[model samples]
Target chain A: MKLGPSRFLGRRRPREYAGGGRKAAVQLYHVSKSYTAGHYALRDVSLEFGRGEFVFLTGPSGAGKTSLLKLIFAAERPSEGQIVVLGRNAPRLGPAATPPLRRRIGVVFQDFKLLPRRTVEENVALALEVVGAPRRDNRAKVFAILKQLGLQHRRFHHPLSLSGGEQQRVAIARALVNEPEILLADEPTGNLDPELTVEIMDLIAQTSTRGTTVIVATHDYGIVNRYAKRCVRLEGGRVVEDAPAHGATP
Target chain B: MSRAAAQLASFLRAALRGITASPLTSGIAIATIGVTLVLLGAFALLVANMERMLDDVGDALHVTAFLEEGLAPEAQRELASKAATVEGVASVRIVSKDEALARFRGGVGRGAALLEGLSENPLPASLEIGLADGYRSASGLARVSGSLDGLPGISDLTSGQDWVEGYLRAIALVRGIGWGLAVILALATLLIVANTIRLAVLSRRDELEILALVGASRAYVGTPFLLEGLIQGAAGGVLALLLLYAVFRLVLPGFEFGLELVLGGVAPRFFTASEAALLLAAGSGLGLFGAAAALASESRP
Candidate 1:
């Protein structure tokens, strides 16, 4: 049922997502984002996440983790540097080009970002609707994704009716439903208990296993240690450490 | 289907949802549009009817040259024939004193009893001359009247040109005021629509930002608001048309009759199809512009 990439139809396959093509999933070069004069949220940060890699961006609050993720999603542009996502210069993408770029990258926020007024199925279908995916295919994909996330029973319920874990899963379903080339999660497990935290972490790990380059940002070193992925640490808007997780092979 | 067609359908659905979500704002906007359009339509109808009345008077183009009180029948006939031969003159008919008296009685109707005290006919014999088509203008009528005034056995000349000039001035004033009001009302409608749509945009900024973030283009996000504006504008126009029809059918006839009492035989006029269609188009234009204004202001970083 899948037609080939038609850019005008918003169905173009980005380089990283196209059948295991090898490319930098994300690259930042001397990137800086400042909200106020002389107050940098991220300053001269250069980083890279390889195709099919799982990485964690670990930082305390206000350590520019969110700002860097936003740059990857093209939500915020670098003040004085370049950001390349899925092999496209993210900061240079024109307004018309940005949405298609965003479609190839999935993002989950700390607050879940699920629409409270929409049912779980509707929330997940939003990604498809915006791109004009066929209605029948959208319903099938939404149901399949919801089932994969173990939220199939709650598909008809509003986000407000779900627990924190279920809602976060729905948010993840929305993010991953389009099979994006890259997944950026900013503290997805921030509000969950330890049991739910491990489940969400494992779910994200599974996507990385499917060759979707996944970057999860958090201040929680416990999950980072348990999952044992490569870790990049940030402090005061700069990367302080970059290494494999404690139990992971180099 | 094409991506744009799909997008349009989605936007329309969203726009309908938006309207249903906020009843008060949408109602206020639609009501404001209706009121503004009604005022404009009424003025247009008034102007149309007044122009019709003026044309009815102008088409006759009659000027009466009164013969001297003691002029002989032969002399009066000669005066009438001479008036007919003037360059702009179409035809001339002589009215004797008896005919003048009979016309006056017919005009006064029941009030003709008041003229019974006069022993002899006090009205003068006159020659009523009709000007040709091109001579009905102010300058044309003036030239013909001037020539008739110099004719033999003529004492005075009178024409409806003065009345036409007065009516023309009234029409000019009405038109000026109508246009002035139209501009003011149009601006008011624009501002009202813009403000209302702006409020809707502000209320939904978070939703819009999310749409923007989730692979929705500017058109995808903004088209629904544009549709909202268009629907609101069209609804207002339809309401105004309905109200105008009600007024024209139920309330205007009595007023028209009273006007006829003062200025006889003038009939009321309503909006023609073309005029109504223009009003609808204008209303939709207002809606589109208002939505555009809202979208532009919100697009700022």
Candidate 2:
């Protein structure tokens, strides 16, 4: 009630989270979210995304892929159950407390969500700026991240001037600039061509290799088939398939 | 640079961008604040000068105890000594009938022949009383005058207390009206400025959503708006000061006769350095508060 630091008393790690003796990065216990009465975006669903895991949330429009991602990021509270992310209860955090938690979890979107007026470097530096990173170091870190994404030359260009693939890279650069522990992308390549789709997904997949838990909510099965990764398929607000990936690549 | 300085730079950049993004709205807010402060500052100056004039008048406290006509010189002298001992009376000097007549002739320089026709001296011998510092106000004047009223040798007592009281009342009335005007205008200015900033904030709803998506806190998000308001307000204050100074210098001297009648030999003046700084600070305060109000209102629901 005080909106202070939370002491979650009942966080005894469940059996589902204890995979290979490591706790999950994200866990939901029958979480349900409803925007209105008798209607739900996500209902009676439970899932776990482990540290350094790459998971794809595949479902049709309104199948709650976005809702599940929203719940994990604390964008909206679960109506029925608890969600634990980065050892903190997502539902218990207040408006003031949410930012610190969000700082550690990077998010990307289909629309890129970049401030159009700002250049690529400025947009990417937003993550560091929020944490009060010094300007010299902020520039250095932004440069390093943009370079990693191969968009360093375009850092000074505005997002509006960038191609769809390039804008998504800017978004990914911002998401990875902080080296967040958890990366959630809501349809990161939804607007790109088949060729650019592979390019963007490769960057996001690379984040998981660096021990960042990456969740990409997408409806594209072609990209999912290309990579052998754990895939959670949702239908009518319920998870009908939770298939763990067989290998890193097929 | 330090982390704080980096954050400060970020906030200032955003604030400047916000102001530049909507120059017309920002300019309107600044102008309204300037106009409001100008009116308020003028009233404050008037009240300050009036109070100073009253202070000067109070320092020259003088009371006259007009003695009964044909009183003996020895009796008048005795009465003067007794009056000096009265509470609140600092000193007394006896003005004989002949001296009073001579002073009257000097006062009416061109009309001395009007008094030359008089058979006997019409002026009475009196005691000129100087009041103590504590007895310089209206209440003190009344207390001292009452004590001398029924004295055997004195026919009447008169002092400047009555006229001072009337003038003080007039000053109070003007001050009251000034404050009333200030309150109404301040409220109007605050509302307009608040709405202007609110509209500005609302226009950037998309940017805010993105900031939120990137995990920016409420303070982190709202600080730019606050700074924008503060800059606008301070600019407004500077504007008001310049306008007031211009009016005081270029326009005030044109009404020299009116100023002389009201202020006497006292120079009509402009705001001192500290007073001008205070006006600027007030404008900044209005702008800062207006932005805060806008942020608070927008946050609700």
TM per prediction: 0.86, 0.93
Which tens-of-lDDT digit does each residue in B1-301 have in candidate 1?
A: 7777776777899999888888999999999998988988888887788888876777877888888999998887777777878999998999999999999999999999999999999999988899898888667788899888777798999997787777778778888888999899889988889888899898887787767767998888888999999999999899999999999899877686676843458777678899899989878888888888888987877
lDDT of 2 by residue, A139-182 (tens): 99999999988999999999999999999999999988988999
Question: How much is the lDDT of residue B177 in candidate 2?
Answer: 88
Which stretches in model 1 have alpha-carbon errors above 4 Å?
A1-22, A247-250, B1-6, B67-89, B96-125, B134-155, B254-258, B261-263
Docking quality of model 1: it rates as acceptable
TM-score of candidate 2 relative to the true fold:
0.93
Clashing pairs in 1: none
Candidate 1, residue B297: how far the Cα is off, in Å: 1.4
